[model samples]
Target: MCRTTLTLGLTGLALLHAGPAATWLPVVRRRLPGLAGAGDADHVALTFDDGPDPRSTPRFLAELDRLGCRATFFVVGETLARHPDLGRRTVAEGHEVAVHGWRHRNALLTRPGRVTGEIARAADLVAAVTGAEPVWYRPPYGVLSAETLTAARRRGLRPVLWTTWGRDWTRSADPDSVLATLAPGLRGGATVLLHDCDHTSAPGAWRSALGALPGLVARCRELGLRVGPLAEHGVS
Candidate 1:
């Protein structure tokens, strides 16, 4: 009986970790409304997570610059400490900079108080450096819990998740594959998730996302979809 109960409990917990499960989980869906798609009409929000990498980030910045597009970079606090300049450049370049967390931690595995602290510190650090308070927060790996959700709301931060992601964190991913994954989700009013660094991903996986971005931007223009930060999605 003990083993059966444990097994069932684990199964439910695993289900909650699923990114797609946000649709079925009311507690998450209510507090995290951006997961399914755009909050506004006519534009799609482009957001990158786990970044501020000096190596890979500059290239992404350049590409967006060339295309006259802007994205939100949800930076990890720990990495930001190591590369404050990259974080600053993100802000300088017209992209929105938001907090991912103090570290890339799973909220479900962390205590509620600790989860709050993680976001608080990250938000403070980001604001201190950028002179702008991040209005949005995205948990690491897109995983969330009731504790994290409440903590985010308490800090005056809105929790957001993506409607479409390129799965650019894997070594197996490339520009074509990334574009393929994003194609189906490419529609007006979608939140697109990609990565700018590989600090927590396969080495050099960030390149896949970087390579696919121009095409993504072009396609958006072709479809008459404007690509910009979450602010355009009315996240703030």
Candidate 2:
């Protein structure tokens, strides 16, 4: 293979396995604030990503209300735009919204200007439709490039990633499987990642998340910890 091809292939592998952006990239990591109270042992941040999806998001919201637990919804710019009313309802229901990039494109492979510009633009779109600019940002697929991090800072948003996740984005994920994966990571100040929409994931994967929500919330309470949005964690 040509040197250029070899370099590109290796870079893709690195970006995929380079740990979480908020921790992996030093330049960006410096500006990124780790979720506060992540070590508090009595608080956990329940964050749902890639949402404001009309079909699945409303279901997640309904479940959260039923369980009396609150969560942060990291919404996509395109999805929110397509379903502005859904975005409005997500905020109106007392959930915090954050940017998840425009159309869920992978920042690592995207151009720097595009990455940075979209961050600002998505922030604007979210703010205009949701009645507030998101104070936090999570990259699409949770993958961030150096420029994406810079863009996050330029937009005045904090970058965050989870301590653990449900793996609920997979088609094989079921309620029990989701709970099993997440329960081990349950603790105060832990950030739990789960997808509210599966647009970028396995089809119907959102069902596993929705099915897992009640038990997850109950488990948190039973452990004497409270589940809340990232804003509640004071990371924003």
Candidate 3:
């Protein structure tokens, strides 16, 4: 019995010295923001940002309609104010509208007062158009800071980051590449980041990424993944 205890103690020490198996903890958390209804099944959430663009948004909405899916739109304060009709349509279509900052400024670099103004102004705009304050905020470029988190929390908005990004902001990111990048995390409970306004890309180049949506949805379904609103997963 003494020998057995010694061996067992040595084994415990060895395990401690070996450190954690990196693979055991996935590089990315399976779900972020800890939404309410997340489950093991393959489920995905779609979101669009930097939008309320008159031309692109309508097209994007039509595409979602074709797939019989709803998405969340992270609207810029300035843009939403410029195109209130587009914002209204997003709500009318049963999509959730969230704030994406006022000027699309990088929240990480912004001052606390500026951050507060940015988020609050955007929330006000979203609430005016949608009849409710936004519950989610996605910092421009997925950049987050202590100030950003604090400001967001104060406004009752949860900071949501994407689990996978398609790099749709790049003009050269064709539909195939976007689909490929997201293929791995397409399983479920994924928050995918795509852009409706790609100023960096060729003029109107986001069309290609938009073109890929239907097929992407089909592929996810084939893999037994269900696509739905983030709120359905208790994200809001």
The candidate scoring highest on TM-score is: 1
The candidate 3 region of ten consecutive residues with least summed lDDT is 16-25
Q: Candidate 3 residues 134-209, lDDT tens each? A: 8888766555556666778788987776666666656577888888877876767677767776643467767866
Inter-residue clash pairs, candidate 3: 43-188, 43-189
Q: Worst lDDT window (10 residues) for model 2?
A: 1-10
Please give, for residues 210-229, the per-residue lDDT of candidate 1 as tens digits: 99988999999999889999
Point out where model 3 deviates above 4 Å.
1-40, 200-202
lDDT of each: 0.79, 0.76, 0.70
Question: Across residues 38-139, which tens digit of lDDT does each residue of candidate 2 receive?
Answer: 535577899988887788899999998988888888888877888999888988999988988886777767765887888888899989998887998887
Ordered from best to worst TM-score, the candidate numbers read 1, 2, 3
Best by lDDT: 1
* lDDT value, candidate 2, whole model: 0.76
Question: For candidate 3, what is the TM-score?
Answer: 0.81
Clash totals for all candidate models: 0, 4, 2
Candidate 3, residue 98: CA error in Å? 0.5
Model 1 TM-score, 2 decimals: 0.87
